[model samples]
Target: MSTDHQESVQELDVRDVDGEPFEQIMNALDSVGESEALRLVNSFEPVPLYDVLSKKGYQYDTEQVADEEWHVTIRPE
Candidate 1:
């Protein structure tokens, strides 16, 4: 997969979820396709997750749309 911009993606919003959403996020990423992406919506930027994703051959871009809103688009590299 070229990892080009993909329209087909899975969006997982964890803003109102209870407890930690790490496992939930991981599971979501696990099901993501090679040519697709995982859009994570959260209350804060998941900076620590960058390393984990990078190690898994994935790259991500984080954008803070609001004081407590962040969006990370994860794509396979």
Candidate 2:
């Protein structure tokens, strides 16, 4: 038998949290125990930023939001 407890995407709004600065968001992640929740960033940059975050061991998923914007969901590894 299969269970039906669908885990919906928990969207932690970045505008309300990060504002714009990535550093401040990282700090917030640290304070809140990164593993406890996920973070979503609304930005378009693909390579450089994702590269840095990957190197830091943050597992993330991305989706296109607009013409040049994307929404990234970040979670702890």
Candidate 3:
């Protein structure tokens, strides 16, 4: 199956993002509503980000949609 399906939640695609996408992700997360989820699309699993978000008391679920595409849904715990 293709990994490019449309997202049903708030999303940010960083595949083409220049520089580090960490700040961009943080910015996107800041705007997430209480009942919403932030989906981060990237070229690979963002393992480092998992630690950062986890320490901040957030929860997430990651799926490797394709060999090069990963989607991480992050939300407040």
Candidate 4:
């Protein structure tokens, strides 16, 4: 996506999740507006979240930033 598109997405960084991260992610997703997206940053690829979000009518793109880091952009389809 273009930098401008990315800039408008609602961002969520979960690399610092104290315990469970799923809840935090779900909350963010819930707050995403129809015209907005949720950008998730994590220390590792959040595989399970892909399925969960997909079932909720969200499409996602994952980019590996480092060996153990990933950036996932989720948007309503």
By lDDT, who's the top model here?
Answer: 1
What lDDT, from 0 to 1, does candidate 2 have?
Answer: 0.61
TM-score per candidate, chains pooled: 0.88, 0.57, 0.86, 0.85
Off by over 4 Å in 1: 1-6
In candidate 2, list every pair of residues with a backbone clash.
none
* Residue 76, model 1, lDDT: 82
Model 3 Cα RMSD, Å?
Answer: 5.9
Over 1-70, each residue of candidate 4 has an lDDT whose tens digit, in order, gives: 4554533588999888898799999999999988788999999988988888878899999999899889
Model 2: worst 10 consecutive residues (lDDT sum): 1-10
- Any runs in candidate 2 off by more than 4 Å, and if so which? 1-20, 32-35
Query: 1-77, model 2: which lDDT tens digit per residue?
Result: 35366333445455554345667657755654433545555555445567767887777778887875667776666
Q: Kindly list the per-residue Cα lDDT of model 1 for residues 1-77, writing each as its tens digit.
A: 35456468799999998989999999999898887899999999888888999888998989999999999999888
How much is 59 displaced in model 4, in angstroms? 0.4
- RMSD (Cα, Å) of candidate 2? 4.6
> How does model 2 score by TM-score?
0.57
